[model samples]
Every structure is written in C-alpha cells, then in structure tokens.
Target: MTDLELTELVKEISLADFGKAFKHQAMFNRRLRTTGGRYMLQSHHIEINPASYKEFGTDELVGIIKHELCHYHLHIEGRGYLHRDRDFRELLEQTGSPRFCSLVQSKARTKPVKRYIYACIDCRCEYARKIRMNTARYRCGKCNGKLRLKSE
Candidate 1:
C-alpha cells in the first residue's frame, strides 16, 4: 500500500484500539529490514515495512500498527513508551499488541570475528581487535612496552 493508505490505516487503528487520534505521519519504509514497524521518538512518525504486508499479510500489519500506536500514544502523553516500561507493557496487554515486530532478527547482533591480535613484547599481555592498527603509535596499558602484531 502507499504511504497515504498506511497513514489512514494507522489513524483508523489508533482511534479504534487506543481511542486516541494519531496526529502523525505513517509511511512505508523499504529500508526497514529488521522490524515490521518503528515509532520515531523525535518526529512521532510511524514507519511500517511494506514487505511485512507482502510476507505476513494484513493481520500482521494491524498488529504492527497497534504496537507502534502503543509507543506513539504513551510517548505523546509523557508516559513510558519503551518496551521495558510498565506503562508500555500494560498498554500492549490491554490492546493485545504484540511485544515485538515479527521477523526482526538484526544481523548487527553478532559481533564481528577478530582479525588482528596484538601483544605486549615485555608483559606478554594480549589484545584482540577486529581491525588492524598502527602499533607504532600505541603501547600496552599494563606496561610501557612495545607491541607486536600476532597472527591469529
């Protein structure tokens, strides 16, 4: 659906579920790969993943809208809007909103594999890092010793 349609749907859901008006923008965000929707704190805008409707259909879309609405309403009224907040959780349960958006596994959760290892020449202390560094400019904090690059 288009952004205008999404905005209307959000407004409809907000009034129906929360009995509050959604006076903000709702748009289809193609870049939102990890979550179905997100409510922006700064702009109070709701971004819905269009792919979610294609993949999960209207029911999931409604749920996402409700979830974002929870955040939207609470944040606007100076109440706790974060997922961990008691007010947010209560709103979720009262509105039957999902705790999280579906199919939102972020690739950023996994730490990158370390590629470079450095060790102090005198203290034998080791440091693992993801990127290579200029050893000439830095030294070990444990001792004022020269550092050497060690192969993994």
Candidate 2:
C-alpha cells in the first residue's frame, strides 16, 4: 500500500484500539530490517517495513499498526512505552496486538548451508562444522583421538 494508505490505517487502528488519535506520520520504510515496524521516539512517527505487508497481507499490517500504536500512545501519554514496560505489555494484551510480528519469509535466507564432516581416527567419533577445520590440530572431545577430514 501507499504511504497515504498506511498513515490512514495507522490512524484508524490507533483510534479503534487505543481510543487515541495518531497525529504523526506513518510510512513504509524499506531500510527497516528484522522488525515489522518501529515507533520513532523523537519524531513520534511510525515506520513500517513494506516487506511485512507484502509478505503477510492486510491482517498482519493491521497487527503491526496496533503494535506501533501501543508504543505511540504510551510514549505520548508519558507512560512506560518500551517493550519491557508493564504499560506496553498491558496495552498489547488489551488491544489484542501481537507482541511480536511474523518473520518476513522473503527476507529469510533460503540457501542450503554446507557442512564439513570430520571423524576421529582412533575412536570413529564424528563431528560436523559449518567451517572447515584443521584436522591435524583439532581432536575428538570424547577420547582426544586425532581427527581426519571425512566429507564435506
């Protein structure tokens, strides 16, 4: 959705969920990584990750708006607004907002990881590591046996 649509949605959710008006701006931010949305403490603006709406749809968008609104309202009212604050948690539960938004599947890494397999020469104990290790120096933890590269 457009920034105008997002701002309207934020305002709507704010009024509906918290009985408060959101006077600040709400816009989609492509730079937001890992978080669905963030409430800017200094500007009181809400920035939502566009990837969230694109991946999860309107229901998730509404949920993110509600979550951000919780932060906005609490901070404006001079109450505890941080995630760890009682006021924030209470507002989340009260408004039925999600404590955490769903992960954007598109942003997640889909590449298969390559693992290096090693075996203890004496004990036959095996070990797997993401990075290849020097078998000459690294030994088995179980019996302290010399290790050898088995497979990748």
**By TM-score, who's the top model here?**
2
Quote the lDDT for 143 in model 2: 95
**Global lDDT of model 1:** 0.90
Clashing pairs in 2: none
Each candidate structure's TM-score, on Cα atoms with residue i matched to residue i, is 0.69, 0.85
Error of 1 at 79 (Å): 0.5
lDDT at 11, model 2:
83
Error of 2 at 67 (Å): 0.6
lDDT of model 1 at residue 83?
89
Q: After superposition, how far is residue 54 of candidate 1 from its true place, in Å?
A: 0.8
Clashes per model (N, Cα, C within 3 A): 0, 0
lDDT of 2: 0.90
| Each model's lDDT | 0.90, 0.90
